[model samples]
Structures are given as structure tokens and as C-alpha cells.
Target: MLDSDYTQRFLFDDTDVRGEWVGLERSYAEVLAKHSYPEPVAQLLGELLAAAALLVGTLKFDGLMVLQARSTGAVPLLMVECSSDREVRGIARYDESLLAPGATLSELMPDGVLAMTIDPTNGQRYQGIVALDGVTLADSLSNYFASSEQLPTRFWLAADGRRACGMLLQQLPADRIRDSEEREASWQHLRTLADTLSAEELLGLDTQTVLHRLYHEEQVRLFEPRSIVFRCSCSRERSANAVISLGQQDAEQLLAEQGGAITIDCQFCNHSYRFDAADIAQLFAGAGTEGPSGTRH
Candidate 1:
């Protein structure tokens, strides 16, 4: 059976090329369940989720990778985040009336700016931006790699309401033994094979089966797969910190206005946290401490 919510890496043993395959089931459904998104919005968000997982799997870092698109079109913003540990969360904001049936990426987000941010726990953050000039998210991302990273990369992404899946192929830098012409020829050959993959195959087949069907004649080596999961990093402590940032006096004033309590809701997971006046007072009192002040959930 195909393993849902996992990513597997593969490489051409004889060429400077590598790839990653990601399939999402439970995680995708969990994200959708949190909101009543429209069909186009949900489908676009799913593709973004799959893209984030594919990109993050290519790196070795202890941080979060964020994929964001901003535009003044039908879809104002779409964001997806994936952590190094394989935890994923995403959300989208769009104008329903503008979303037409069977809309392409350009129709939904005309003149959009796509930004990818890498925020590491122990290092400085880095970001790259590219214009949404392509009709599909995969094409725009491929353009990003060409302009920003200067690496040849291609992506095939597909999603239904039930599951989201994606495949990525990247050409690595040539080493001393590999000549430029030979590397180019190898990349061309691999890309030719990858171009034959269909959305139906990507969404329905297992990683091993899909790779074999595409690169059956190539020297392909598959690596162990890693599980992906839906996990929100929100907590009462983080919410309390947001409240504390408003200052003690403002927090009290807000509490009074809200009938003796302030409610904070997490947009990602739809988790509600209520802080009463006493809770707010105690939270401020413990603000001087070096660690998290409020109770965790």
C-alpha cells in the first residue's frame, strides 16, 4: 500500500541529479477541516502545502521554511509552513466572489509575488522572491530556482480535496570528473523522463512505483522515507506572550471591555484560549520570570 504523509528521496547513481517525492493524506485533510475553504482556495492551498514539503526536504536545517504568495487579485495571500521535523501547517485568505470556476494560478493570483523564507533556530533567516509569471505554482517555483538559486529544478504538483502529492527533480552542481556537456546531457535525459509523469499518476501511485515507472532504465537509488504530520505550534503560553506584549494596563482594559476575559484564537488549528482578569494579572506578574509565564496546552 502507498504510505500517506511521507517523503522519500531518490538519486541517479550515475548522474548529478536528485529528486524528492511527497504524498499527503491525513495531514491535508486535517488542514482542510480547520476551515470551510472554497474549492479553488482549498486546491491552491493544497498545492502550496505539497510544495513546501518538497522544498524543505531538500535542505538540512533545524528551522521552518515558509512559502508565501501576495497579490491584489482574487487570492490576496496564501501561506504554507513546513518545519525540519516534518510538521506542517497552512492557511489562505481570498475573495470568494473573485474565484471563478476552473481558475488557473494566474487568474487567481495575477501579478503575485512569491516569497520563500528560511528561518533557522540557530542562524539568520534568508528569503528569496520571484514574480508569479507562470500559469502554475510549479512553474513559478521552477523560475525561482533558475533565477535565485541558479540550479535547474522542476516540480510536478497535484491535489484533490482528499490528498496532495508532489515530485521534485533537481540538477546538482557538476564535480571535477563530470564535464559540463555531459552534465547537461544527463540533466536533459532525466528531465525528459520526468516530463512524462501525469498528475493522475503522481496523486495515485506510491513513490517507489512512480519512480520505477519513470526511471526504470536509469540507475536510481531510493532512500528511507520520513513521515509528515499536522502539528500547530500554538499554545496558551504563546498567546499569553502576545497579550503581555500589549502591556499590563492595555490587557486589563481589554479584559474589562470583553466582560472580564479576553479570548485568543489560533487561526491555524482553530484552538480557543480564554484568559480572565485573574489569569491576565497572574500572567503579567510572572512576566518577570525567564521562561514561559502562562499555562501550556
Candidate 2:
């Protein structure tokens, strides 16, 4: 049986080109279940999630990778977060009334900026910014890697309403192939094979079949697959901390204004956390020992 929601890493045994394959089924459905997003926004979000997983798999990191885009068009914001552990979540901000039925990505996000942020657990955070210049998300990312990174990288991303999938192939630093011409040839050869993969095959086939179909002539070593999970890191404790950060005066004032429990809803998961007067009292009673603030800088 094929792994449906797992990300697998593979290396061309004879060359410096490495690739990653990610398929999101249950994880995709879980993200869609959190909100009733329009088709275009949903599709873009799925592609972002898939790309994030693929990048995290390619990079060596211990924390999180964020793919974010900001626009002044119909869709204002698209964000996807993938942890080193393959946990992924995504969200998109859009105006349904402004969307045309067949609006292209450029129309949806005109003059947008795409950014990739790698936040490590023990090191400094790094971010790469580029223009959203391509028709698809994959194009922009591939450009980022090729130009900003100065590395030959290619990305094939696909997402339907039901499934999100992606593959990434990147040429590593000079190792086995030291000659410039040989490295270029190898990179082009691998990319040529990868370009033959269609969106349908990517979304429909399993990892092994996909790899074999693409690189059967080459020596490839497949790594153990890592499962992708849909998870919101929000918790009641965090929500309560947020409430506490508002200070007692404002907290009580809001409670008075509402005439009932103060509800804090998580935008990512749409889960509401309510705190009543008594609950607020208990929270403050414990806040002295916890800290005066709970905000992250």
C-alpha cells in the first residue's frame, strides 16, 4: 500500500540532485474543514501547504518554515506553516465579492510579495522575499531558489479540491560532479524528466510509482516517509494568556461590556475560548506566579 499523507525524501545515488515528494489527503481535508474557503483561495492555500512540506523536507532545520504572501488584490493574504515534524496548517484571506470566476493568480494577488521564513529552534530566523511573478505558486518558489539561492531548483505543485501534492528537485553544491558542465547537464536531465509529470499523475499516483515513472533510469535511494499532520498549535492556556495580557482593567471592562463570558476565537481553527468573571479571577490569582506578560517578541 502507498503512503497517502507522508513526505518522502529521495536522493539520486550517482548525482548531487536530491528530491522530495509530499502527498496530502487527510491533512488537506482537515485544513479545509476549519473554514469555508472559496475554490481559488482554497486551491492556492493547498499549494502553499504542499510547497511548505516539500521545503521543510529539503532543508535541515529544527523548527518551522513559513510560506507567506501578501497582496493588494482580491486575495490579500495567503499563509502556510510547516514544522520540521511535517505538521502543516494554512489559511487564506480573500474577498469573495471581488473574485471573478476565472481570475488568474496575478489578478487575485496583484503586485504581491512572496516570503519564505525559516525559524530555527536554536538559531537565528532567516527570511527570503521575492515577487509573486509567476502564474502558479510553484513558479515563484522555483524562481526564488534559482535566483535568490543561486541553486538549480525546480518545483511541481498540484492541488485539487480533494488532494494537495508536490515534488521538489534541487541541485546540491558541487560534490560528486565537480565540473561545471557536467553539473549543469545532470541538473537539466533530472529537471527534464520531472517536467514530464502532469498534475493528474502527481495528485493520483503513489510515491513509488511517481518516482519510478520519473527516474527509473537513475539510481535513487528513498528515505523513510514522514507523516504530515494537520494541527493547530492554539491552546486554552495560550488563549488565557492572551486574555491575561490585556490586563485586569481591560479584561474586566470587556467582560462588563459583554455582560457575559468573554470569548476569544482562534482564527486558524475557529475554536472559541470563553472566560467568565470567576474564571478571570482564577487566572489572575495564578498569573502572579506565571508572569506579568505572556506575549512573544
Candidate 3:
């Protein structure tokens, strides 16, 4: 995987809605390394990662956006989180014994919901869920946009061994007197061109080149790119704070049973952090001296 990749936000001057295209290579590789996932599961995650970035980048929201799938099948759950800064992390839960070699989402996950959560840094969190309504990740996402946003949207996602990429086209909201029929005609033409895109082209072609191939007749404005990277918000201090939150008695008992300190492992990145007896003691002592402090370690 490469270090950090870029997500480009683009707008059609005549269309009401904005869109984004993101290609992830190294970031996706880092996320896939968190666990041993089957090929289907890995591919699902790559598409989900690209989709999550697309949604976040398109909205231009200063919040955390999450894409999650939960089901009562072999692949029970999968989720990816992306912040406005383009930091990303994800994980999947599955029945290893039941994993098929190349199960599709319909085969492995079956009935499920694709959920999106937007947690604004200063405001409330909003969530929207859509039925597993389409054949692939991109179609499901387009269905979500139609249902939730009432906007005509399209997604094209593709991944090979080396990189994963996705492109989105959306019809923005328009004014009453803007000749809606003309806009619709343009949209129809653009959509037809977009349909010509193949998986190989999506993953292999450069961003500008792809756009040119699809929308050569349209007036498109490409925004400044935002860099995306694999970033896990896990650390020893966070783990220690979690232990402290368990209360001194419970924490100490677990430590004693385990023979020493408490060990915490992050599910997203598989990073482990351990706190020794001294660390625990210091934590409780500080909490006592600081007068019921709500501070994190």
C-alpha cells in the first residue's frame, strides 16, 4: 500500500449535487491487514472503504461518517469509519468456520442493511439505513441516495490486487426556473456515458482522464484533493483510561486473575496495549487526588 492517497471532490456547474472519486491502495492494504479476511470479505471491505470516503467527501461535513453492515449470516458485521480529515479505519466480524472461498455479499451476508452515521463534532449524530437493495456495493449505495437524499445518484466501484477506486455522479437540487428538462437531458447523457465505464478503467485510469472520458461535453469543476490515510485512534493511554473506567476493584481483580497488568486490544487495528500494576495504581491514586476527575489518561 502507498502511504496516503487523495480523494477528489468534483462538481458539475449545471448540476445541483456534488460528487467525488476516490482511489485507495495503501490505506486499504493497511486496513485489510488488521485481520485475516477471505477474498470476498476483503473485497467487500475495499468497496465499503471507498464508498465511505465518497460519502464523507461529497457532504463536506466536519464530522465522523460511518458505513456499516449488520446481518445474521456468516459475515455478521462489517464497518468503516471516516472523519472529515480523511482518516479511516474499519473491521469485520465473521464466522471463520463458515467462510466460503468467494462468497458474494448476497451469499455471505444475505439480508442486511447498509447504514450510514454522521456524527457532527458539535451537534447530534444522524443515522440512515437502507435495505440490501442491489446486486453490488455501488448499486446499494445509489439506492441509499435515492431513498435517503431523494437525489439521483450513481456509483462505480472497482478493485484489483493493487488498488481500489470508486466514482460517483449525482444530480444536484435545482431551482424552479432553471429549465429542468434541459438539465434532465444532460443528466441522461452523462449517465449513459458513465455506464460505459468498466471496472478496469475505474481502477486503472487517472482521475482527470476518467472524467474526460465520461463527461467531455460537460462543465466540471474539480476541487482541491483531500489526502486519505489509515489512521486508528487507539493508544496505551486510551486503553489505560478504559481500564480505569472499569473501577479500581474490578480492574485490580482482572489484573490479579491474569497474573499481572490488564491487556487491551483494539479491534480496528489489532494494536494491543497493556497496563501494569503500577500504572493501575497511579491511575486510581490520581483520580482520588484530583477529586473525581473525568479526565482520560
Residue 157 displacement (Å), model 1: 0.4
Q: Which stretches of candidate 2 lie over 4 Å from their true place?
A: 287-297
User: How does model 1 score by TM-score?
Assistant: 0.94
TM-score per candidate, in order?
Answer: 0.94, 0.92, 0.89
RMSD of each: 2.6, 3.7, 4.1
Count of steric clashes across candidates, in order: 0, 0, 4
Instruction: Find the 10 residues in a row with the least total lDDT in model 2.
Output: 288-297
lDDT of each: 0.88, 0.88, 0.81
The TM-score measured for candidate 2 stands at: 0.92
TM for candidate 3 is: 0.89
Residue 207 alpha-carbon offset, candidate 2, angstroms = 1.7
Per-residue lDDT for 113-231 in model 3, tens only?
88989998888899999987578888888889889865788988886646778988888767522687887887777778888999999888878899898888878898777789999
lDDT of 3: 0.81
Overall local distance difference test of candidate 2: 0.88
